[model samples]
Target: MNTKPSSNRRLLAYALVYKYRIIAAILILCCAVVAELGGPYIIKTIIDGHLSLDEGDMTPVLALLGGYLGLLVLAGAANFSQSYLLQSTSLQIIKNMRMDLMRHVQRIPIRYFDNTPIGQIVSRIANDTEAIRDLFMSFMATFIVSILQLAGIYTALFILDYRLALFCLILPPIFVLIMYVHLKYSKGYITIMRARLSDMNATINESIAVMPIVQAFRREKKTLEEFEVLNEDRYVNQVKQFRVFSLSSRNAVGTIGALVTAMVVWYFGGNALDGAIRFGVFYIFIDYLGRIFNPIIGIFDQLTNAQRAFVAADKVFGIMDMEGVEVEDASSAKRPEGAVKFDNVSFGYKDGENVLKGISFEARKGETVALVGHTGSGKSSIMNLLLGFYEPGEGAITIDGRNVANTSKQELRKHMGIVLQDPFLFAGDIKFNVSLYNERISPEQVKQALRDVGASTFVEQLPGGYDEPVVERGSTLSAGQRQLISFARALAFDPAILILDEATASIDSETEGLIQRALKVVSEGRTTFVIAHRLSTIREADQILVLHRGEIVERGNHDTLMALGGRYYKMYQLQKGERVAV
Candidate 1:
């Protein structure tokens, strides 16, 4: 929401990258303008000379034509140089803009990501930034050229006939007013159109990602209908925008045409004007006048698009304006003693209705704690807080007696590793996905990590071993295989504390056995927190915490909690009964 203004001054900050090249482009443009004016002057000379019918001056007429042709060729070459400079400048700006946006995104807090839509973010990076770049590259030079041409024409007309030049000035003000109304009304519609298009894009993205579920449930028709609704909204907005554009364009050009027609008739009607203005001179004046007004109208039209471009840039800069994750230390902070303590911690998504309340607990320097509860019982919320994904509304969390809020998230997370229910794997080779391009770890270390997680056998069985492409989100690999790769990634870090959030819940019994064994070796002598649906997995935990409605209702080791006959005992009994039935 805190978007920055796309100030001309701000855009000028990029001059450091393309200043010299742009200067060359400007010089080319100047040469082209000189040629443009010079060619028309030569035509005026040829026309006047022929009207006089002076045989002695025929050679001068031929020389004027030759000079005009030469100037035209010069203009063509200058135009090519201008085009080359503009393209190179635009590409360079786009490269730097993307890099800046990416770096800004990296620093934004995780909470911003949770609240923002993936499609909107995609639009900012791909669509919005591109819109800005195109607006710059296409309009900036044309706008400058139009201004120069208009200024030159005005001066030429004044020098030729001051009375007609004054008349021409009157029509531009009226045209400007019409364009102002068009731009003011249609700018808002442009924003709406862009937003609707983004919504449609998001819908398409979601549908494609969930195509399997949609097909399995036979909801294709419903999805199509929804898409139709979105597309209709976009069409209506676009229509409105185009209609305003058309009316404004016609009003500006038609008014100028009528004015030009009246001026020609008025000038010729009087003997004083007809005696002075020649047919050739009049024709040239009309041609130059049309050229002048056409670009003026175009500038007005482009102003509307420019407004839309600014709105998009605002959205992009807004994301960049958000508070970045604070970095506590420049040098990597040394690992703390992995002693976690939650003292009177309470937190909620909004401001009220706490999801974690007055919870007090500790996982010693080298211990395993399992949080078990039914859905919406704050198990995941606690884990989220531990990872600093969200801050507590009341009280504090400490690692080795230092409050988490005081330390940088980057520093805090260096000593911690998390293996979620679904581990993310980028599209790359197996080795690259695991190492994530961190050069500190070697290929041999990657192999050892995979072997430690029991993933080496299947990985080697693949066609290219470590070189095999994982595909998007590692879909080429099975769920169990993906989990093993995640485990390998976590183990390779050699973290002091590991957070396992429903890690083995989705796997089969055989795969779970393999994972559980690997987890034992990896988790030993390290503080670990496990959230599990299966009661059997935490039977050997140093302590077990049972949550109920944001409060810890029961706490003990596996046997003690079962002996106490509380929430944990009830959950254990339910699982045991289900196992017996199976």
Candidate 2:
């Protein structure tokens, strides 16, 4: 019944992806540890065998120096090889994990994004993944090297003297206890610290994205205060975390090292006082003990990073574990005829509260259906269902007499295109944004689509023409220009179903005229749905549905609605300053 893998298990699973390289690196490190340990014993041998004597053979001492130097060379070479292997392997794992998180994010439903801040998602990808890389590089590497170093040192100690070596075996359990106590005290701080960091990131990103509005409304100080609160919270938690870290890591390790050193000196010095311990043997035990704690200190130093990485791992993997919409490729058989219908459909973003109630309408091929409604009147909800953005709570939506729900969302959207009130553009050339790098849309189509939507007038005057470098979100372009590019983008795909949601609400009259002309041409042989507040643009629509309070109160052509003198009549008159219907 346990669906979630523990953090340890998850890390082991990802590490196994490069098991071969990790294994090879660990093996090389073990060899290096043994080779490095050999030098101390050799030094001890030379001291007791030759240096301590009144006279000794010079040839034997010379031979021992050569052997000691060779062990150092071997250790140096092995250390370099293992370091290179571990670093490269760790980098690749993190790279793959970051990429995987990004890809999964695309398949996540719109609902998750609606509730989650974009900054949190971004922090997970950019910052959290970077922390995980440290887990493998510093934590895993140091821990592994420490284990090998301890084994070599203890092996050397037992050879020198068994009783002291057995006493040293207790070091592992003591370090484990220190780490446990540190985690018990500091885990709360780390969790809160990371959450605050994510909150800060989200707040900063949101503020930067809406900076123009913030500055226009003179809310910069307020925004800064909001960011400052999150930053301060993070700082407080981090200080607390470091407080625990400072006590548990180097200080504890150093204290343990000093205690061990005192005991060994006492034991060995007592025997030396009795003239039973050799100078060389006594020196080697001290040397081996120092060697042991050097690695112990190193391993302990990475504990804080290791804990942060564990929390970061939970975040990165949690996203990957979210059940994303399965990627279903569009059907390739034929283009749709674009006959769309909503049959008594009811829907809501929240259960038991329908935003769209009992909506039923049909638009045959080549018909222009205009949806007119005040804010929150379910006009956009109808389009959302038709485009497979959300499912209808009750009843079904169909295209060409077949239920749309039977097909995958990708398949349903293949023949559809939509332009929102606020159009978005990416950081790319004008042509690239139009085609969106779809190979099916050629250079010829990009030019013609621009011409069709009247974007060419301004585009041709730019230095790069279609290749003009657009900054982030096309901030450099005019509102009308961005809308027109989005229009061209929709048209270049030449979709069978086109929905324009308040597409002309922000444009100047001249730009609206260009779009109207483009709409006249593009609506032929396609099912076009327009959600508009500007009633004049929908005058020639084949059908006009006026919605109020999640229900269509009136339905007819613009002329018929005017003649009926209903809600549509009153709304139109209000916009045009007409006292009565014309």
Kindly provide the TM-score of model 2 when superposed on the true structure, using C-alpha atoms.
Answer: 0.96
User: Which ranges in model 1 have alpha carbons more than 4 Å from their true place?
Assistant: 1-24, 50-58, 250-255, 258-262, 269-274, 278-280, 326-331, 578-582
Give the runs in model 2 whose Cα sits over 4 Å from its true position: 50-57, 331-333, 580-582
User: Each prediction's TM-score against the native?
Assistant: 0.92, 0.96
Best by TM-score: 2
Candidate 1 displacement at residue 342 in angstroms: 1.4
Q: How accurate is candidate 1 locally (lDDT)?
A: 0.82
| Residue 306 lDDT (model 1) | 74
Clashing pairs in 2: none
Evaluate all candidate structures by whole-model CA lDDT and list the values in order: 0.82, 0.89
| Pairs of colliding residues, candidate 1 | 3-318
